[model samples]
Target chain A: MYNPQAENIIIVKDLVKKFGSFYANDHLSFEVKKGEIFGFLGANGAGKTTAIKILCGLSYPTSGKLNVGGFDIYKEREKIKRNIGYMSQKFSLYDDLTVFENIRFYAGIYGLRRKEIEERAASLMQKLDMKEARDKLIRSIPLGWKQKLAFSVAIIHNPKIVFLDEPTGGVDPVTRRQFWDMIFEASSEGITVFVTTHYMDEAEYCDRVSIMVDGRIAALDTPDNLKKHYGAGSMNEVFLKLARVKVE
Target chain B: MKRFLGFVVKEFYHIFRDYRTLLILFGLPAIQLLLFGFVITNEIKDARIAILDQSKDEVTRRISEKVLSSGYFILDKNLTSYKEIEQVFRQGNIRLVLVFGPDFSKNLDKTGNARVQIIGDASDPNTANILVNYLQGILSNYLISLNAEKIPMQIVPEVRMMYNGQMKGVYMFVPGLMAMLLMLISALMTSLSITKEKELGTMELLLVSPLKPIQIIIGKVFPYVFLAFIDACIIIILGNTVFGVPVVGSVGLLLLESFLYICMALSLGILISTITSSQQIAMMLSLVALMLPTILLSGFIFPVENMPWILQVFCHIMPPKYFITIIKSIMLQGNGFRYIALETGIMAGFTLFFIFLSVKKFKIRLA
Candidate 1:
């Protein structure tokens, strides 16, 4: 069951995931609101993927009070799975499958009917201006196009929230802009976007950004507020100020 | 159920699209079976030998004729002296040297015994041993016929090879081939396909979907079951038509047993995928852990009884050993359920054990 009244789509409190004695995610708490672009920024080993996986129901938390898309993380994992979509840092589409086939397969697994899958797939191809690539295998496409198609396929079922873990990692600058434009379009359509990225310039695009350092959030605020608070000119400078001291 | 079907359809796409997978799935089985049947066999034929006939008597000539005409050996040279025995064997084309003692007919009639020195080249010991056995068989049969009227109270043991009358190597290889091919295609290919999803990061997307873990596993494994069953059929048909290996038992029983074996291999594949995160690791594990034991210790190429006792213990645990036994009994011996009941039960036990372990080891969530 969905809670239409719940403003925060993802709520986490004291979330912790441990590996033996090492805490991959330590006391991480944040809230992602409905229809908002939330940027989760961190360094390579700062546990951004761990938190994203936990929120997407791809991993269990060691101990936490968490809910995703209004479903209890512990008790209603299957429900959480139905209500959200995830795109990992690695390319998510099957390389051997054609674009339309990839779209149809992922959509079908989420319980979409055949007609629904075909209809949505055709419309998605039109929206992305990818009619020529519809029959092309994913491996034949460019990495930027693959990432974009992966994002579209992830949200093919119109889930309440979509989680992108470094979706634009290897994409060129022009394609990254286009990718973000697609993200904005999805958010405008009332889908909450929870994206994790190490690129600081990408951070300025989010409505609000949280920077994690050493398995804990170092700062959380709007991009401009963090810049002004840290007396920096850009989000990059703010990030350096937040994470550099801890690095030393 | 629809979702599961769609997942299986996707799995078929993955399998059919890759040319390498297609080659490995269908091509390897035929090639391996033919190779095992014709090229790599234990049966010796047309082995060359040198005969030294010191006695110009009828008995020695008949014995030499019997040895050379048995079709197992060809006369390379007729040596005139004992010194030529070492030289002929050293020449290396001849596999054996048959040296008949001088005055052989006189000695056998007067002393009731004669020495025929059979010196075999033991460099390739197995072939040498087989040639010696064939020569002995021919000589003993000739002696039996020569003494038939004189000896009336000799107790001759009647040996009847029960199932394989010709003792064709092909009959043995058909079952062994089925076990190996099914295990390889079912276990190695399935493990690779599943771990491929993990390696390429598509597993993360799959894990987030509404499809449960069990659904994902079954979907991934279902297509391989179909493919491996087809492989089993191909091997059986080829073995029957090409090698004339009989399927004397009920075809339904044979198929049921093959289905059970394929299930066991598929479950083992799932177990391997759960433990390893990379396709390379899964492949290595399947090859090293499954293929070697199936070929060496499962009574495939080497008889398990002839192996070391420790290896026999290992063979008992090898799932393929029971399967090979079941197949041989069913295909060659034409036995019904009652005859191979213990082996069938053991195979079922292995299938259940592997399924249980894989389910227990399966990760509900990515770690």
Candidate 2:
């Protein structure tokens, strides 16, 4: 099902997001190819979230030529929204809803049919080995399970692109590994994975990562190439070296 | 439509799953109605009173009998001297003391005016004021009856409390309760629910989905419309059965007017959610902005005409004021649509205006 043409799933040229006098995402540009695991690496307040929000259509950019899933971010927000999925840093599942009900709700809002929603929910629960927790309330489950369930539900509609903002902030090493495995599985299935994280270790897992510093993309390339260029042994050292410089 | 239904079903889960919120939503109206009906009341029954009849004559005896037979007062003491009236009132059992001047029958026959002084315990001023009015009403009716037979030139200016003859406090409270409770449940609940989604970060997910902003708002508010409607019904039914408040006009019209008011309150809730970012702020805004006005300025407990000019202007702007008027006219006066057309129109106008404002304020993109 993957697109073989290697078309850019997201295109941004000179994007500027300003809040009053502050440039939250100042003069940023990047592109993500189809089915690519593109990492958005930045320290806190480095505008990774602002850029992601603009790209997800949750917000409007002050000035930009931007497109996501072949739809203009400005005039085609609804169309873009239908084609993209987002999971915020905060847990997205309703604590009151059961696992199955949460999945059904998200799928239903995406216009999935009743049979399709049921089938997908069952398959998703089985895939996550959470069939026993299907009828359990989200709050009764563990935080790791809730985060995993949130990501599964976000992409249940099979959107062309999925945005994960710090999806694995507090999960244990084992669950974080499982989460990355899930991301890789999704990326292999031709779903463009655009994720933001402060964890530099997670940066190495991306096929190509863009490091944003002070509202601008300071570096954009594959992990090995970035490590080689910066003369650093790890992505962490590379990020620290890049972020230490003040972008004036 | 299916998406909206799904959202509404989820909302029901949220409401029913939280037993505390559920209790507040359903139990509060019943408790408030009972409290206002039984505890805080204006109607008096079997109040202990003393009669100080100084004349001890036929006319005085007949008037005393009339006063005792009214069923509003039970004779606690009958004093022969004016000095005992103060002692009876100080004992506090007697809410009112009827003091008749000496030679009452001789004075009425010679001058056509008998002096019957009514002294009421003024510690509880509202009850005392109402008791005094009751005594005055009874005295006037007696005088009118006396004039019908003996005096042809006397003008007694007859007074009748139309719709609420006994002046039952529940008659006044049912409509006000409906307004206040409906505003509380509909506006406050919806605002909190929507703001809760924002606070929990679920709103970002929904906004990024295929669901439109209007759909999200209506879906959030739909369950409250149903809940608030049930609350309105509960208040009316309790007011009717427990307190014997009448629904003299059309029940359908009353319910329809209540539904219009609920819509107005629900839209007001959506407007609140759009302006606030958290549930606490939404709750505070709903209570401080909606509750106080519904109670104080809406003619619920206090009459709008009695308020100061500035407050009267505020009362005119209050939607509950119009809703209370509409319900009172329909439920008490047995009034038709024509009698409450203006109030109904104003309520509909408020609903539309709030809907318009919330729609305008609902941002597609996060600000």
Candidate 3:
């Protein structure tokens, strides 16, 4: 796959998002290449969700130079939005709708035609081996299946960049592995993946991961390299060491 | 445009697929309209009254017959003593009591006037007042028929009921029903729609979608507008069939007014949803803010003109007040566009203001 060069798919300079007296995201800057599995690692309230929100065009940056998919977020928000698919930590899906219906609804909103939606949904379900559950309501499925389905629906239209915010939250280990396989599959097809996770172990799956502490990037590197550089045996130990250093 | 339509379709699916919301959206208005139109009304009909005849004379009997035949009161019991009055009222059926003095015919024959005491249950002041007024009118009419001596009265007051000729309770209630039903359905629907997203976690999903803040709000509100219209139709139909309230004005004009009112209510609902993150809060706010004001301040059950100045001013700000006035004028008085244009304009202004406010608030939340 063709990877993005210094021309970053996502580029942020001194990004700041404040909620009243509290700065949710403080002077944060980051860059991700095209076709990169960029893991955004942070503890709860580390501004991971806030940063993802800005990148996905859901919220405004207080003062920042932010660009995603070659479009400025402020003026070209519509263009930026069109290029990204976001699955929030909640595994947001309509519980009342069947799996097929949910897929169609999302696809339709993305302006996909009926035939395109049908073809895409069929292939995606086939890949997930979710044909039997396709007609069942989303609420009836297991949490693991729902999380995977949510991730699948997020990128159903094949956005240039897919953002998964804690996508494996509350899911089983097996499901997490299966989910990573899907992410890798998307990356192999030249789709860039940006994911946020509290699970430090899952950070190992990212091609390059950025660890955020107190709304700033405390560390950014490949998981193997981060472990080696920190003199740690695993990504979790590296995350813990970085978190302690930042707190100090 | 296709994307917007798709968003709206998803909204409809959310509404229709939830049987609870569907029932409330469609069923609530129907039930409320029926209840307001038929069950609860101010028009006094077949009220049971007790009569005590101490004279047992012809004049007393003739007057009692007149009272019973007026259709306002039904002579349910003949009480021998005054002690039975409290018992009759406590039973809750008797609303009026007429007590005749011992010299009923003697006084009338000697001075052309007889003393009769009218005792009414004042627990419900409005019902008591109406019953008393109705009894006085019947008595006055009976006396006029008995003696044809025309005495020139000093003050000849010509009272004209402008809008409703008979001042039918249904005429007043139809418009009130429209305001109430629209508020209930619109507010409930919008609140539920917002809460459903929060509950299902789809709001975060939509926030992350390519849809703009405005598009998401429009998508959520669009289906409710259609649902509110359906509720309006149900109320109108119920008002006509059950209450015999004729729509005097142009149906088109009434509908236009109703549309503006629905928009105002829907915008208010959207505004409430923005402040409240839960369905329970939405429902409570809708009920307290929308329902009560629509009922009490909009001339639905009580006259706005009769309220205190502060309450009257508050009523002026309520969208339903203007809507009720326009609707009542149209449905009862057959008022043309020229007559109700000001009220309709006011309603449109409110709709615009609410929409503007909600959009501003929504944008602020996103920002």
Candidate 4:
């Protein structure tokens, strides 16, 4: 049972998003609790990214009662942005900058002092055991390391929630496993994670998952419960069965 | 504020690390100043002309000597017959042919008048007219000394050129150089910085950051202001030291105006970056849009006043035209801000307008 008194990290009610009269997110509603690892699963163009953009304060929902970290996205966008971290699928780290410099730059942009940036960078790099490659440029590092570093820098300010948009995309299984471990660590520290991914195995890693299809949440429950209800062997089978049944 | 400082420092790192940017920021202004200062000039030096001295008298020889010694014209060949004058003119090397009639001195004494024809190749009419006038002035000066005994019939007007008094090309070009150099650096920086973010995928990251749209723009523009200021200083120093062009107005005022113009140019760069998605397009757009107009329409090389009505109207719209006007007025004419208030105001308006448009475009993109 969801706690009645405990704070909801994200609250969305009747969200509607339109791009030139083409509805991307229509009448969508969801709630994510504090410190919860909420999985948002959808195929490409299911309005998942649009919904995330509105939540992250990058865009305005057409009509909605959207809240992130107890702040209204429309009224307190700047405050919301300050208290949330975002890592995009493209892995937005400066390729020309060294590992330490990238960390310092992001920390600075989040309004950390020079000394504070240095201190936090040292701790973050230490946590990742990246001391040997701190001076190396991001372009010189492997893709997996870059993704991990991007995620770490996103949360360097220690925000209440971190939004990961396909954070494990394109990485191998081992790297994806390591990326999820970091996500778990963040959630353990009372940081809510709102993630969207196509990887079904990664979906099982979340506490609760929502499968969106055609701008609507087709199914929402624990991965195990959904698998049991659908009588499927894995999350992938459940998702495939749901997708096919909707088409029929 | 701390985040803004960090962003600015990172911007400095971007500028300082790139060798191509370093060259454009520093190397270009210096090279352009040197070229404008020395190699390119409007002042004619040792212009070659042939003399057809039919009189061969002492007065004619003395007059011809005076013409050759003025440092304007060098005697290239002495023509024998009148037919040779046409051949020399056809060669295109001789700009002027000084023809003295057989009765040049006698006609001067008896009739109180004399004929000395200066036939110049009129294909390039402006240069030809200038050459003819110069030869006439030299010969008249010689005749004036001999005509004290007789009443002087023709009153030759004394002309004194001002500002670039000698009409040195560098003096004319220095202001142009300042506008051009600032435009090049500003446009290149804005375009490259934006495209670089797109290339590294960090633009999206910044979009997701807590920094406001205005903060990102201000942060990107800050380092470029410093680079443009340094370039302006180099151009001014080279203009004065190498080209002998004086800072006739308040040097402080000139610097202030230069800073304002740099902002205008940088704003244009920012505007260009807002529309362009790649570095190659930005560079090409800046070169074609900013560079060509700054050179041709700003009246740097071609006289905008003499251009067609439409082109002159077009030149009026260019930011460099205002900048060049202010620079020349302040640096060469020693005119104060009061004299160039309108031009300075126009440049300031342009800066504000560009900044506004860029911010609007940036915000729209974010939305």
Candidate 5:
């Protein structure tokens, strides 16, 4: 029943996850604040997915103290689940389902009242400028629109936080920018965004970024601050500098 | 409750919208029932044969009359020479040719012996064998009648076939078809659909939602259970109407037992989903582990009693084997729960065991 403190919505302390003596996540710790976009960055096989899974309640931590939305990870996993929304790297909407059907499905599982689901779904379509395409199956829509639709459905329940696992992978830059616009709009409505990405440019758009190397948090700061601290001119160079160091 | 209802509705959407699943769920049972009931049956009707009576005597003519009246064969031709036997068979219509030796009932009167030659087309071995057997039965009965007055003390054997009196092939294959179709819809299709969600990454999204793991699994199973039940009804109706196989037991009890078996199959599907993470792997495992084993070892095409010891042991472990047994007993023998309670109990036990095993495995894999 310990408090998560005033500013932080997520708190992790010495989170250790091991798979048969191999530490997929080794002694990790970080915090995400309310209404802030926190970017989680890592190279492939650097354990970012494992950490996100732990936070999302999809996996168990070997040993650690973790809390999200003021609920213990060990005791109140269900409460944590209720408070968060997630979209995976793959566009997770049903390809056979229409856009409105997809939205209603997520809204329904979140236990939204019928009238509320209807109102939100109509407005969600308006926001995406997809009212004309609302009845189209997800497979028939363009990739960019599908990605945006996926993000919109992920937050249909008005969760306190939305987790996007490399949400912009393989998307065009213009669409990625539009997607970030939606993210900014949600943050303005006080929905904290916790996202992971391989794109350094997307990392720069986040309020703060954490880089994990070899299952440990090697760097955590504002993108501009990290750039200045490393004496590099861009976040890309800053990433290259940290990732090239070999771990003993 | 509303939330769970919505989840089930979505599942139904997936099922109905997919044409492939629809075909397998509804179309397959009917196709299989017809194929096994009528087209591939073992019973013979109106087989054609030719007659060659060289003696042209009363005995040969009487034998020919009896053969035609048996209702199993048609007289394709009356041949006067032996060369016509080979020619009739080459036409592929005649299954057998009966030839009588030269005699006017003289040999039977003088030496108390008569000879007849039966030539059969063996291109299709099974039909040839059965045709020969039927001819033998007809000739032997005729000979018995002829010797009725001359025999001294004789012992006659009374032969009566119980359960299925005529050994109709539909009686045997209908129960087996029911087992295969139910398992296909319940276990194989359910496992495929569940793993499809995992492969598409929606399972991760669902897990991150408010729905509990058990609720998710149940929601996935409900639609398939309903579909499989409908399929079972279709098979039973077809078996009764088209094939004339009766449900001699209580109709309600038959449905209830089928429901129990469907639950067992659905739970096994969930267990398979827990172990596999991709649709292709789930599909391969379901076909290899469940479908093939059920069809081959469940006494469907082959009798479990006639199988080798190792295969018999395998059949005993097969869930569909017990289902086919229960179906045959209840439908053919007019048996009630008193007779098939053991199989029903075994299926219920499997349902519980699969549910428990999947719960434990799911927890250990994640939290």
Candidate 6:
């Protein structure tokens, strides 16, 4: 069960998204607590992205009761968009632009003032230990550094929630751990983290994990509780146990 | 508004860094103008022809001399009999064959009538037609001189070639090149830049931001408009200084009309962007649907009046047709906004239609 004391920042009930005759996301219900890392796990074509898109206001639902950042999904999409940060599998930094330029570009889009952008960009570079790479073009940096920069840029606006879609894909093991540490640091600052991944080991790092099979969320619980209830050795075994029941 | 300015600055950064795009934006137009203005021309320098004169009389000889000295034809071969005409035509080197039927001077004295046959290879119809027409003109001059005292009732027709008295080739090509260049820069560049962001996923980030979809599209198109305006200025200056193409009308009105045409092209580009999700598709569509049609059907190189009925209908719908007509009216015809009101009005209507259609087609969701 989810923490009873933790406040629900994102609430969804009977959320359904369809593409013509096909159901991309079926009736789904879940709650994400404030300031906790929530893992959205799924196989290919399991509709994890559909759910995330609805929450982020990038897509419309066929029928649903969904709320994000205290705004109704149908009525206040503009409000929800202002309150959340997003990073997709493909990094959205301009390759031809320098690190400082990329940071300024995103911060500028968020309507940050000139003096605030200068001050915040300096501190952000110091925190990421990327002060040296600040003037270097994004294309000249390593992939891991670029991924970390993308995440830092995404949260530069200090949104209440950050939705990361496979942020550690193709990253090495050590870098993935470092990325999770960053996520934890972000969560400690009272920012909610909703991330999707296919890596089972990463599921244990989340405060709560949801396993989506087909279009429905098959399991939603803490990693240890999910393992204990399924009588499995790890979160991986629990995921497989739930995913094996194929939907018609 | 500040956020929109930031977006435009980023677009400029992308454009400045991509040297290939920069070249296409600025260099291609100048090079195309020079190539079209100087290299590709409508005038014939020297055309080759063969003569098969059966009656080698004084009159026929004098006519052949006059035709050769007209500077349009070079006598490639002289044949003795009728069989040589077909052989020389099949040689593929000669463009025209002139044959004179029996005694030309003797027949003129007896019956005041003569027959001269000018045969042209019609494989390349334009050049063949020009050659035949030139031969007929020279023949007429000779006939008028010969019958100067004989026919007092000859009605003299006075002709004058207006607008381009010198018959310079650049006058026809400059307006056309302007239309093609502006379309490529304003329409093609905007669509490509937009679809590039979609492919790179940056567009999604913009969508999720506080920036509205309209703001995003406007920002993406703003830099191209600035660059294309600079391009239009360069085309006008070069056309004036290099080719002596005068902007005889109000220069301000000419530039104003150019900007309006640019707006129409940009709206078309946005429409193209809305319907496509990939840069390659956007580029191919811009080229096939915009560039090729504008160049061929807009009466740029070929006259719309000369095209087939079906194609003339297609040309009427083409936006470039109106744009080219307006430019020529302003530059060559020295007409003001009053004279070009119909053309400018049609272009404005096209811009509104495209903007309305694209805004309708644009959807915020993949669903």
For every candidate, what share of the true interface contacts is present? 0.90, 0.86, 0.74, 0.81, 0.93, 0.79
- DockQ score of candidate 2? 0.74
- Tens-digit lDDT string for candidate 1 (A1-248): 11336498889999999988999899998887888899999888899988888888777889989988899998999998888988887868899999999998999999999999989999999998899999999999888888889899988999999999998988899999999999999988889999898788899999889999889999988888899999999999998888788978
Query: Which has the higher DockQ value, candidate number 3 or candidate number 4?
Result: 3
lDDT (Cα, tens digit) per residue for candidate 2, span A1-248? 23336899999999999988999998898888999999999989999998999898778889989999999888898899889999998969999999999999999999999999999998998899999999999999999999999999889999999999999988888989899999999998889999999788899999899998889899999999999999999999999899777642
lDDT of 1 by residue, B144-220 (tens): 99989999888799889988888898889999999999999999999999999999988878888999988999999
In candidate 1 the C-alpha lDDT for residue B254 amounts to 96
Question: What does candidate 4 score on TM?
Answer: 0.88
Local accuracy of candidate 4 as per-residue lDDT tens digits, B174-199: 88888888898887787779777876
lDDT of 3 by residue, B148-226 (tens): 5566543435789876678776777777878888888887679768876876678877877777777888888888889
Q: List the residue pairs that clash in candidate 2.
A: none
Among incorrect, acceptable, medium and high, the docking class of model 4 is medium
Return the TM-score for each candidate structure.
0.96, 0.90, 0.94, 0.88, 0.94, 0.96
Classify candidate 3 by CAPRI docking class.
medium
By TM-score rank, best first, the candidates go 1, 6, 3, 5, 2, 4
Write one digit per residue (lDDT tens) for candidate 6, span B208-276: 888898999999999988888999999999989998998878889889999999999999999999899
The C-alpha stretches of model 4 lying farther than 4 A from their native spots are A1-7, A113-115, A228-233, A237-248, B49-67, B75-151
Predicted candidate 5: interface RMSD?
A: 0.9
On the 0 to 100 scale, the lDDT of residue B114 in model 2 is: 84
**Tens digits of per-residue lDDT for model 6, A140-183:** 99989989988988898999999999999999999999999999
Q: Give residue A210's lDDT in candidate 1 (0 to 100).
A: 94
Winner on lDDT (1 vs 3): 1
lDDT per residue for candidate 4 within A1-248, as digits (tens), equals 22336588899999999888888998899899888899999988999999998898777788979988999988888889889999999899887779998898998888888888888888878888888999998889999889999999989999999999988888899999999999999998889999999999999999889999889898988889999999999999999988897789
What is the lDDT of every predicted structure here?
A: 0.90, 0.89, 0.85, 0.87, 0.90, 0.90
Candidate closer to the true structure by lDDT (higher is better), 3 or 6? 6
Candidate 3 versus the native: TM-score? 0.94
Q: Which stretches of candidate 1 lie over 4 Å from their true place?
A: A1-6, B364-367
Q: Give the best candidate by DockQ.
A: 5
